[model samples]
Target: MMPTPGFPPSTLNTEGTPIWITDLAAGDPNHILHVVRGIEPAEALEVLGAKQSLIQACELPDSTPDERTSLPAAALGIEPGTSAALLAGRIGEWTFVYDDSGFTYDDAATKALSADGRMAATSVYTINGDASLTYAVDGEQVQWVNIDDLVLEADLPSMPAELRAAFEAAGTIELEGFESGEADRQIAMRAACSLASLALTLSVLRRVPLLVVPLG
Candidate 1:
């Protein structure tokens, strides 16, 4: 997706959606922009007035050929299977997932993370017209955000990892296990979304190292 006037260009991934979000999270220009939850930008602006909006690319490496990981976005040298819609991101000292498509690969997302990673947040879009968001702060589900209503303003309470499995449980879905053929792409898409959601949720909660199921 193209960046707006003030927004910086970052990796935007798409499994099969029109509205694309950048990887980075940006703060308000004056740092007073209220976090927006499940609301349309126009609606938010209408109600909130002309507040500065900031968006940043998530530092997590994107394997997507369009987003650019080790090389430029235009570079054709990206590794196979890395050029997908899922990736990881960082928030303060905490590390979490920021995926576009539902499914993710643990090996790719967590390779740069520490051994004992803390759970942050994950975003998923379901076939049922649901923009589901799961937020695990300090290793627990504090809130569930719908896409339009997602406005994170609360300071994340910091804590140390008691277990080393959090990092191991993130972004490990297999997309190929889902729908096959052009006819099944829609079915596979929903399956991918579900798989992505679970993989992200588990990782942040510090649960058993889960796996993500996705297409190659």
Candidate 2:
């Protein structure tokens, strides 16, 4: 579906229905997007073990592809030997952690972030065509899926009904006759993220002043 004119590029349909979790998957590969429920951006960073002292505020503008990829680090004056860089911001009730280097997909970090009545979900898509979606709650992993193959890698016995329904709708549950391609993988990822009410528009992501944290 075409994003509305003048509106930030979103997964929303013309009728304002959110069609996907995020558009990042369709853009660059080798990116990881994490959403944590009911937490401030700093708190999310803390849970990920990023030092607050190294966090810098930066404006990521919606621009050309080259600029989009290089601007964040440039704006932050990222130093040499920086092992990881993460852009963090808050949207609605969720705090989003974005890493182009795909370094934000730690299972243990997800579990830690989801502790204390919070929920954490992450979508990772690598340039090698590896993709996964994971959800955790209260310091435990509740669901994990291999998005590239549309397989349920792991799940609890009492999985959330909403999540099960989402998987079914995305055709990940019944895979005997299911045929999927890259587009289908994106759909599956979107369904998984939608369960957590996570959606980020490119415009919004660029306009927001995000916290840039560099990790060793």
Candidate 3:
């Protein structure tokens, strides 16, 4: 599958669906600009609309690949079997999203995600969607909200073991607590900032242990 710039190599892993979402899926008009550039949650909403509720009805898997395509729309025409393989990984609570579209895999993989109750959304949809696919501050569901710092910190490691440890040891992890007020509104934005910082830090850590890099 074709890859997009500025995405993690894991995005290419057909078995590991991308986890970094954008604001294009279900956010309000004002927040539409935040969606990650590639994943097309908003576009899917345009095509699926209220039908999105169907995602909750499926039997999703635990994990999925995280690719780097431009938008969900990019994967719309991919093969079904590839989609199926990709979706098969997203069966349970351990599902994934991408910075771009899920085009590397086949259509069946995408369908499998829908079939298993897993969800897909761009950063925009996660942040701006009327309903967010991410977890709320108190673990509630907010279609367009961002995940709390605590949630991101807690979840990042679990997203992938080797990757998580690598990041942690590298001291590149940057998940700060939510602001005192307006937690939801700032979650996505904060995550974006923290992630960007983490990326830069990780680059250095990957080479050598900085003071922040743990010995674990």
Best prediction by TM-score: 2
Each candidate's TM vs. the true structure? 0.27, 0.70, 0.22
Give the C-alpha miss distance for residue 77 in model 1, angstroms.
7.5
Candidate 3: tens digits of C-alpha lDDT, residues 1-216: 222233344322221112222311111121221112122332323222213332221222222333322222222323322331111112122222332222222232233223323333222322132312232111222233233333435555454343233223322222244232322432332233223222222222224211110000
Off by over 4 Å in 1: 1-84, 89-96, 104-119, 146-216
Clashing pairs in 2: none
lDDT of 3: 0.26
The worst-scoring run of ten residues by lDDT in candidate 1 lies at 25-34
Name the better of 1 and 2 by TM-score: 2
Residue 210 in candidate 2, Cα distance off native in Å: 2.3
Q: With candidate 2 superimposed using the best TM-score fit, by how many Å does residue 106's alpha carbon deviate from the native?
A: 1.9
Query: Candidates' lDDT values, in order?
Result: 0.26, 0.60, 0.26
